[model samples]
Target: MLIGDVARHSGVSTRMLRHYDALGLVRPTGRTVGGYREYSAEDVRRIFHVESLRSLGLTLKQIGRALEDPDFTPSALVGDLIRWTEERLEREQELLERLRAVDASAPTGWQDVLRIVELMQGLDSTSAARRQQAVLTRPEGVPVPAELLAAAVLAESDPLVAGALRWALARSGGDGVAALTAGARSEDVDVRRRAVLAIAGTAEAPGAAAVLADALGDPDPTVRGHAALASGRRGVTAAVPVLVGMVVEGSHDVEAAEILGTLSQDPGCAERILAALTGELAAPTADSATRIRLTQALVELSGDTGREALRRLARDDDRAVALVASAFVAVLDERSPEVPGAEVP
Candidate 1:
């Protein structure tokens, strides 16, 4: 196939094909006497794989290395991509914190100001954690500011806050399980939240299951959502039932749907949860946001099932419910998976 045919077959633009060729990432199988690129069927396959890895955030260099080495594993590549993503997230968090600080300094209503202040404080804590991660992971020999880092760690007990601190410590080659577990059980809601979130990031911890289970029933939906997400992260089979139950009976449908979505990432749990949702059981909640999330989760589980459910829900007379349902239908339709082994959207 010529360059145009190759581009059409691979769904990559001609410009990108040239760029890949230039980088020696995906060279053409042959060249015509006229000097045009000619790609083999095998070349098309390689291009598609390259696109998939690029979509997963692999840099061109990383992709080249992986492609060049027969022993390179997809899991190893994904791990590297995840590390890059975390670094980007940390930088974005820093920029967000700086923006929040400016907003806090501006004149505003007392309530708004207070909220901004709280947000700024949280951002500061998150940035501190990111910095700690950098210090631990990067090869640059700059020493971390221990006193400042300690103060950042001790500032407040928000689940995200505590989780970040614990994550930083762990990344920095320290095991602070005792302190993290203590924080998880603290009387302070923030501290407990942090503990739950932090433990979720680790592979397995002794008391994490109990702590997360306790958090599942927290009065605050924020706490409940974090706990439920953490439980899903732990990948405990017991959590699947509890998370599904929350979807059915919890007042906060949005959070419950999020937990359910997390659980549905497991194939068995996904099938069971979809059956429960599409069954004759009463709709979990009438809230549009909740319904939208549930519909999306179902779609993720099985597009046809999710599409049918959304169509049924869209028939409701409630304007908000119908609107969100329609949106869900549109999203699924656009991204619907191919029936006979082709990509959906």
Candidate 2:
């Protein structure tokens, strides 16, 4: 087959066939009577082989070695190809994410696009300080996209940098709540924890309350506790049980108890919370430490219901419980404005 005929049959351009011939990659096995290159069936088959390997992202030089080197094996070359393809895919994914963020921002011009790109670079910087400054210091009146901030917050392992990212998302006025909610559902525990913290800062934002409510059931205790405390502060009665549990378990018990006390201020909730605390104090398994925490929480509550619970706890069976409860009771009886700390165990 002549070069032109070979090009037509194989769909490889004649110019490319000549280049391949010049490089001895697929040299024709014959010459036509007119002194032009002529390909035999075997040469055409080799040409097909070269094109097949090229489809796998092999460089032309690598393809040359693969086709001609007798001892060359595909194992190492294939491994390298896989790694290179994966790295390219990762870079493309990052670029796609940046483009989506910039599009979400609705940039007005090239300058806006440049600024957004610069901020994204800063957020992805290895230095924690740069990431933090990226979130904190955007151009005047050029709001950072909430989606970008949400992504940064979820990936940031550094506490200080993560706080800044969360704060920026919070101030975006719920624009990124959906993104943060996605993070909350991530399989990664750290990502979920960061999402919950970011959502807590925006507890007043639309849909943030529901996210926090859902997070109350998270498997991680820290995520659940943070969600519970934030929810309780927002007056969600569903958080009461979790907060009480925290007090009992001694994890962030102080904050949990204080929030519980606040939840008790509702006229309808007041009785329920007081009963939960007092019931724990009276449980048979209640130890000195548990009773003391319960008593301390009671002081944070208001109205006659709290005073009455403290009055009953003042006569508890345990001497330590009785002592702490009596002290709180005396403060309640005197109607003093302030309550002192509970004595050590």
RMSD of each: 27.6, 3.9
Candidate 1 wrong stretches, greater than 4 Å: 1-164, 172-174, 203-210, 217-220, 240-262, 265-268, 275-285, 330-345
Query: Pick by TM-score: which candidate is best?
Result: 2
lDDT of 2 by residue, 30-139 (tens): 89788999898999999999999999999889999988889999999999999999999999998898999889888899899999999999988999999888878877
lDDT of 1: 0.61
lDDT of each: 0.61, 0.85
Candidate 2 global lDDT? 0.85
The per-prediction tally of clashing pairs is 5, 0
Q: What TM-score does prediction 2 earn?
A: 0.91
Model 2: CA > 4 A from native: 69-72, 283-286, 336-345
- Model 1 Cα lDDT, one tens digit per residue, 129-235: 65444334433332222222333454544445445555554553334444466666667776566555565665355555776777677666556666666676556
